[model samples]
Target: MAPLSDPAPRLARAAEAPALAALVERAYAPWVAVIGRRPAPMQDDYTARISAGQTWVVAVDGALAGAAVIEERPDCLWLDNVAVDPAHHGGGLGRALLRFVGREALRRGLPQVGLITNEKMARNIALYQRLGFEEVERREEHGFRRVEFRIAAAHLAG
Candidate 1:
C-alpha cells in the first residue's frame, strides 16, 4: 500500500470516537504484552474525550490516522494520550502530532506541554527526548510505572 500524506490535525468530532478508539487500540496493541496487560489508552472513553474537546485527530484521505488527547492544565497542556495507527508508524505522523501539541500549548498561552508514558516503552521515551521533552520524573501511577516528560512551548514554536 502507498504511504499516506500527513494532514493537518483537528479537533475530533463526537462521531469519530469509534474510529479514534480503534486507532488507539491499533497503536497501543504492541505494548500490551510488554506491559503485561492492556495499556491505559486502550480502555479510555473516547466518546467522553471527544465531547470534552480534548481529542485531536489527523486524517489522511479522509480516514483517521493519528490522534492526541490533551487537557489544558493550569501550567501546561497535559497530553493524556498520543496514538498513531501502527501502519503509520515511522511516517512522521507522530512527530507532527507532537508539534501540534506544542502549537496547541502556545495557543492556550501555556508555558509547556506535559505527557506520561509507560517506562516499558523505551522507544517512545527516546523519541520524546529527541523532540526536546525533558524528563520530569518517574513514579507508579494507577498500577503502572510512568515516566513524565515536559517541553517548553517556546521550543516548539515555528
Candidate 2:
C-alpha cells in the first residue's frame, strides 16, 4: 500500500466491468449490514453503464482505486454512484471523484449535481455536506430510506 498519488479518472471500458464492480462492492461492503441489504451499486448493470460511457474509473499508479457512475439528466448531472476502495480510503479519492463530477456537470452545462445515499450512511452524508451538498429530502424507495443531496453548479464555482 504505497500512499495514493492523485487519482486519474478516465472513462471506463466495457472490458473493465468486472474490475469496476469489484471496486464498488469492496467500497460498499461495510454499508451492507447497516443498510440491511446489498446496496444498489453492488447490483448495478456495469456492462450497460460502461457501454453507455457513464462510468468513470479513477486509477492510482495504474491500479483501480475508485469509480463514479454519472448520468446526464436534462436539468442536472445525476451522480448515481461513487466508490473508493477501502484499501485506498483516507487518501481523498472520494472527494476527488466528487470534484470530478462537479466539473463534469459544469462542462456539460448542467445546473447541478444530485445523488442519493442510504440514510444510515451518516458518515457519507456528513462528507457530502462538508463538500457543499445540501440535503434536499429523504424518502423511501426500493425498500431503502434514501437521503438525496444536491450541489448547484454555482456553488462549485467557488
On lDDT, the candidate that comes out on top is 1
Candidate 2 lDDT: 0.87
Encode model 1's per-residue lDDT on 21-87: one tens digit a residue: 9999899989999999999999999999999999999887777899999999999999999999987
**TM-score to native of every candidate shown:** 0.94, 0.93
The residue-by-residue lDDT of candidate 2 on 79-133, one tens digit each, is 9999999988887777778877888899999989999999999999998898799
Task: Indicate the residue-level lDDT of 114 in model 2.
Answer: 96
Q: Candidate 1: global Cα-lDDT?
A: 0.89
lDDT at position 83, candidate 1: 92
**Lowest-scoring 10 consecutive residues by lDDT in candidate 1?**
1-10
lDDT of 1 at 85: 91
Cα-based lDDT at residue 87, candidate 1: 79
